[model samples]
Target: MPAQADPEPVTLLLVLEDTETLSSLSDIGEQEGLRVLHAESAQDALAILELEPVDMVLCDALTPGLDGHEVLELIQERWPDCIRLLMTDVSSGLEEALRAIDEGHVYGFIPKPWHEERLRLLLRRSREHLGTQREWMQREMALLEQNQDLIALNAALEQRIEATQQELKQTAEMLDKTYDELLHMHVTTARVIGDLLHHRLPRHLQTNEQVYALVTAFCETHALDHTLQQDLQLAAALYNIGKLTWDDHLLATPSEQLSANERTAYQHYPVSGENHLMAMPQLKRAAKFVRHHRERWNGNGFPDRLEGSDIPYGSRLLGLAVDFIELQRGMVLPREVPRPQALALLRKFAGRIYDPELCHDFVKLCVEKAPDLQTSGKAVISLETSQVKPGMILAQDIYSASGMLLLHEGKRLDQHLMDKLKNFEEIEGRNYTVLVYRP
Candidate 1:
């Protein structure tokens, strides 16, 4: 094994006018194992800064050209990374020194004829702070590099998945660690696309989250594979992304309102969303589910008309979720119905339009989780956004000014979700009547 090398010493610059203080600082630097350089004036300090990399700068408050605060402020503008300490006469320039601390120009003020103990402590802390700053910068650079690699990985995901299942699992794990950073950049891309859908389709706000909630609940209740569960959740967010290609007229019209040609165009969205997502390998399973979400149980569904158990299990669960939410949105029908009615409408279509057993299991999951859906008579209260608390079950969906559903009925509130609602209120300037079933 090779011997390790020594760490580079800390470099410091002194622009002190007091000869006694300058000599004391140099002795302390040597004890601290620092590479110390002294400057006669502020101008000399600036010149040295231009030539050499410095970790910390100590400037005299009463220097010949610029006072200590003024010198540190100048250092801040040119080389803001260095830790700065100022020396000042406590009585004469106290206000100027205080203002420099407030404005963040000077890191700290050292009174003239400083105590050795205090000076040593400040220097030790400054070294620690510099180390932390450098560490954070390294992390930021690494994250940027990871983001570029992630983008490339997302681009070639299809080819990579075909190579080996072990490699596929490894890629999935990386995507998990930086899940928020995977593709579409910065945050989850599906969420970004979901927001886009919220803008283009108001019904999306009303139904998308409900779809996700239903799909996830069903997946969990059935104890589905963790990876497949993640794929279904992503699919639930994006099943209707193909609707982006539709014209405003087609997008705005209800299914019952659409003409034959428009209906045909509407049925194409599931396939369209799948095609858009197919190039990325990680999302292939999700895309497959999105592609077949419109398929029916008895071969009446569109695109390929996959019937009964022939459809992928995730797609089957996803389709049931989509219909259950959309049925209540009045998206597939003329008039909007309440939650209990929506469940009934979903049940009515089970055998012919949906997988019967899955439909039955979904209704049971809904009734058990959403107390307000039951006829067991739970008291419901309507509260303002600020009044709602965590653990309370939402009795009704909260909608945006644009009629996009912000939070779905039966969703539980946590501090994070409360913060989201507060931010939304601040940004959108809207108030909502939040209904919660009493615990």
Candidate 2:
């Protein structure tokens, strides 16, 4: 292997008007491992400094064209980091050296007849100082690069976080829309099944309408959720759906007069209704309502026998409505009971068979709010299909010309329902005379 050559020594610029002094200092500098560049005048020294890199500059105070102070000052201004020293002879007294030091133009002074050892020591110290400054510059550059990298990383991380938040927001919106569409589909399916059942069993259909009316009033008084109210409505319309599987004798017998086998069979209807509704995920909440509607308040009812608050809120409300409707229809007792008698019976069984607070609220709604719902005092007007509008309530059942029931009485109309009626009329060519409460 070839040996690596030794690195070049630190270079020093010597500016002097005396040739003898320059020759003497050059010999000492080379022995001290320094490269000496000779400049006979201050102008020559400045020119050399401009053209090359020099570690230090040693200049005579009385140099022609520029004194030591002038040359040092120029070096400090243009190359501030370069070390400067003044060499003073007897002619250039201590006063010039003091002025150079005071003005911050020179690092230190070297007297004439300068010792070779002292000159060598000063040159070695200057080289060490230059080495320290170079090390500091390298460290500072590394720190700057690290700071820039950190800034770029933070910017990229922020962009990723913003993108993730936007994706989450869009996903939430999509889920809400999908839920609403699914809910609408379940409501439509339940209504269609209810209509079919009502067509097969007209008497039960009438009972469902009355029960649904009571449930609506009860829910409105308690400030319940509108979605929950719709669920209760669907459950009530299909309450007796399980009776479809029963024989004529079991179906004919009044619920209060059923034998042990018939009553046991009747008790299973709620479970049967739950099974029918459980297949639909959107109606799962309604299925739970149906399953527990028959439960009594004191835990003595049927099926789950859930007591008090353990029963679903919708089921509690349904229990009250079903009994009240059954009472009025004479299905509970042998003779048809009057509304006042039914209210009294409900008050009698409040804590036993129904939630007491709900039963009390139900009685008030019936006596006070029920009359307001009736078409007797409301503005009931008959309108042709062309005159129908939204926000109106149907005062009487809307039937097709063929006597098929289109919409039930006391049902509120909206844009969708109004459009449905109009569409049916236009398509079927059967005109409808609908009696609606004036909005």
Candidate 3:
């Protein structure tokens, strides 16, 4: 015989006045893996709630004395986390439902003749939410343990207690472990957000050789250090992280098209994006770029008013690149502008809108690199070994025209070996492919 699997615990409280309603709800609740507690009145419901941990509350609006609205209000006061659902029999009782929604803290309301599927959906979502809450609670409990350890350490030190050093060491170790766990969590979250943005953005970006060429030449021309170059790439890719907090509707609309409230909501993206990156100390420097990415060279930008040299160099580089991309893609509004026109516009606003020196270097790079920046308009199959030079990063997977994986990054193929690899038939047809930064 196989070992038995433990049953999932069900934790839901049902407060219904009508006997038939209770019977129907009970059957559905049990089938859906919930342990249902039944209550005929508000007082009984309150007692059961105090005795058992409940994840959700379902009340009947038509109940006599201490109606669903009043019961929901009381539950809101005591158990604010519980998902509240009220079943209404009469259409006129919508006011109570509104009150429950506005003040009584109801998550949702269902009609009296409720569909079983909708209830099941609500319960499933409620359970998932409860699980996330439980995870947070576990973290809080760990914090409490650390606090107790600190208290013990303090008491031992002040009272000249024995084993004070041992207590201090143990407390230090626990704190270190806690910090490591939190740090890992922060990194994992940032990576997830990064992956989401990469997947959702336009694919044409991969083929735009001008973008990469201009950026690289600009870095070289300005004599920018390697770290600043890396910062530029990271900031370019993540310039819009703040947009994640924004509603899809608002993000899709032009800034001028947004309503007053939507505009206010839109301003939060930069701060939210910064906070998201700042959580991991490893990426703290990267977070600073996101915060200052929008500042103009002049003293007129959002969130902060830092002008010219006061704005970070990394942020200034990203701001220029992102502005170019937005203009090229016509993200501004009305219509997308041509590359020459956009460049001309950038020139027009150089000193006031962008750092004059940086803008000049950027434009010069684009002009000088026009030949190398030209693409053959054919899909790049695999990167030639000759083109696999040092200091260049792989933008995407290297694949043959037949879709075979070639060389992965962090794998060195210095000039001579690259020459032989380039001679292969699969690699012969493709020109030097675009090199993209991975990290």
Candidate 4:
């Protein structure tokens, strides 16, 4: 409980002016568990005080060369924390003795011939008082030490919180970077599937590139959110993936020219495409768009005839993009239609075949943005695979003989790309036209 106050022991100094008396009193103090020291004169007592600390003092009224009261009063001035007592005989004036108690601040007076019982009782009481003081001081010291420990803990806790905040910030940045990389990888994978379909149908026509282009343009001009943009673009590219599993005869035939058996197998391609995309976790959103892309505005469509608002909004957009391109490619009718006529067919069946409000927006987008539906506005020169060169820009989309856009319009050819074109024609065992801007 208390230490900045020096922990002096419970000790008593008896200044008797007689050696025999000092010896007897010292024994009594010892019995009371006190550390006792005795001196025969004021000089000896004052000297002991200089050498060591004392808690209680008992002195004779007639001290050698000095009054006991004077010595005790000196102790008061020098060490106020010490307790002072005086002893005297009948010859010493009682009035003087009582006055000493008041003037010197003495504890009590003792008779000239002290009683053992009285001395013992005083020593025991002094010992109890010292013990109580020690307990109180110890308690005060313990509280101070606990306060110091709290200060240290508070400092450590603040440091830990700061470090934790930094760690959380780093983790968030890492997650954002990872999400961007995964998005790039997903888009690239969808493009590869479109290339695969190109190879599978060696001589057949396809609208994969035109659908990809129109859908991407629409999303940008319309400012669709990122999730919707990604989903519709991937669906546009991969909606015909199910046709890969079909026989060449079925795939080459137009929709209106297919037999009843072929038509039944063809109608199920949309679901087959959905199943293929569901295996990839990143394409889960796109898979939903692919499955319902054929749903009609009324109640009659293929795969799942979800009508009205039951069809997801992104699926509706995918449908519009696919039909716009495929109609021109002659995949929807027995004969291919021009871009204007294809647009007319979409408008003619708008409320019954597509979401009318979204169709209105889409039809307008195609007319405004698709200025080169057949590459009309560009001066062109055609080259054989061997004549192509690096740095020449493609005036039109470069397609495989089977109608896969190997490179898009406006791409500047490089040696690596030229090598790729030659290598592809080499594998296919046929040559195709490469149209480029006249340089």
Best by TM-score: 2
TM-score of 3: 0.40
Ranking by lDDT: 4, 1, 2, 3
- Can you give the TM-score per candidate against the true fold? 0.46, 0.58, 0.40, 0.51
Off by over 4 Å in 4: 1-166, 202-204, 371-439
10 residues in a row with least lDDT, candidate 3: 372-381
Candidate 1 CA-lDDT value: 0.80
After TM-score superposition, the amount by which residue 24's alpha carbon in candidate 4 deviates from its true location, in angstroms, is 38
What is the overall TM-score of model 4 with all chains considered together?
0.51
Off by over 4 Å in 3: 1-195, 198-217, 370-439
Writing each residue's lDDT as its tens digit, candidate 2 over 1-439 gives 9999675468889998789888988888888778889999888998999899987898888889988888989999999988898888745567878887887888777887677777777777777877787778779889889888888988998998999989998999999788767766666666667666555554742466677667866777778887897788778777777666777666556788998988999999999989988887767888899899999999998899899999999999888888877776766776666555677789999898889998888877765455223544565565776787778887756656554677887798888888889888897887766667766
lDDT of 1 at 185: 46
lDDT of 3 by residue, 1-439 (tens): 9999684485788888778879988988889888888989888989899988888889888666698888888888899888788888646777768776786478778775688898788778778877787778889999999999999988878777556767888999999888666655554454456656545545542212333345555777678876666555444445577776555566556666678998777766767878877766666676888788778889787669889999988777767766776675656644655555566677898999899998887665543343223344322223344545555544333445554556553354466546655665444575434333422
Better of 1 and 2 by lDDT: 1
Model 1 shows how many backbone clashes? Answer: 1
Superior candidate under lDDT, 2 versus 3: 2
1-439 per-residue lDDT for model 1 (tens digits): 9999686578988888778779889999778878899998988999999998999998888888987777888899989999998888888877888888899998886786688888888888888888888889889999999999998888789566667777778888888767644533421567567668778766443566667766766777789887787888889788878888788888767798999999988988988999988988888999999988888899888789999999888888888787777777778787776665667777998888888998898877765564223334665665777888889988767666655678887798999998888888888986655668878
Predictions in order: lDDT: 0.80, 0.79, 0.68, 0.80
Candidate 4 local lDDT, 270-361, one digit each (tens): 88998999999888888889889989999699877789999999888889988887786778788876555677789998999999999999
Off by over 4 Å in 2: 1-132, 207-238, 247-254, 257-260, 277-285, 321-350, 357-438
Q: Look at candidate 1 and give me any clashing residue pairs.
A: 205-405
- Cα displacement (Å) at residue 274, model 4: 1.7
